[model samples]
Target: MKQWKLGLVVVLGISGLFSGRAIAAEEIILRYGILERTVAVSDLSQLAETGEATSQLQSYFDTAEVPAEEVQNMLNSDVTVDGVNINRILDNPLGDVLLDEVSKSIYPESGSAGRQAMRAALVLSAVDDDRITVIEVLENYPTSRVVLDTERLAETYEDFQEVGGVVVTVEDTLDDVLNVIRILETLSN
Candidate 1:
């Protein structure tokens, strides 16, 4: 009787472990730009947990065939990473409007892809016209957030004299950027 009980307990434990993994591996739609990516949520969580700086989530973004230079520039900018003070730039009326506009554009009234796009666009729109002259939003990590320095990117291009509204379908706003980071931190926990 004791042996049977022990065997049953072991089997249950193994089953529970597999079940947990399956749950983690469940497919989830990650939105960035005008794109909806169906991938394993567990994979994103794993990338976040490992503290891998590289956007392992890029594979999903690639489906949209976004320009490589644009993506690279956005990643290299300040908004892409964490621990940057964007409070001053984002705390303005224009900044707020920019975020709202992007939100509406990407989310629209329906469609999962549209909603995801809007979510991504919100952050893309926040790029400070002064700092980030140009921008490119790549991926959305449910566990980790990325911000685009649109203001800075604009500066690099001579044609873009004024930074605002230069990068279409990108969310580079300040508050939006911070909010996404907050979400990432929450997911990480």
Candidate 2:
């Protein structure tokens, strides 16, 4: 009888974790080029969380100018045990292009999912310069600090350097909001 009771409790606990409204609302803002857009941060339960979404999200990070290995770990990670999502900040036209491409690629599987990711990416673009300058991609990383030394990642550097841009990542685990701002700061002196 004791074993039965314990089993029931475990089952109930597991079910409770899975059973919940899929729609999660969050407050966030993104700026791309000179346009700033405000949007609610939430995950669509209807979409059903899947590895494909994780893979797609990773693709953006993979193609980025930063270290591929580090980026991969970050995107495919659920660092926060509390169910909080990490935020990534990518700077410049490349960042904008990445979001656009992501939206286009994911349109068939899920329009809403693509839009949400793009919207999130756009929120990070705090500048509307139209020209590709600096691209800072900051993510809300988990407690575990992952060192992605940009200097070490040469192949990736070659890919991004062709376009002339750099991505700086900042990790803030506690913050519920993953906000990133890419500013042109100054023109070539």
Per-model TM-score versus the true fold: 0.27, 0.21
lDDT of each: 0.37, 0.30
Off by over 4 Å in 1: 1-35, 38-63, 67-70, 78-89, 102-189
Off by over 4 Å in 2: 1-21, 24-93, 104-116, 121-165, 169-189
Number of colliding residue pairs in each model: 30, 19
RMSD of 1: 17.0
What's the CA error at residue 12 for candidate 2, in Å?
A: 30
Please give, for residues 1-189, the per-residue lDDT of candidate 1 as tens digits. 345434533553465366442211134444555555554434434443452323545655456555444544433343322112222333466545444444332222233333333223323323322133122222221112223223333433333223233332234565588899999999999
Q: What's the C-alpha lDDT at position 91 in model 2?
A: 38
Worst 10 residues of 1 by lDDT: 133-142
Worst 10 residues of 2 by lDDT: 78-87
Q: Which tens-of-lDDT digit does each residue in 19-97 have in candidate 2?
A: 4412112322322234333322221111122322234333433444334344334333221111111113333455556
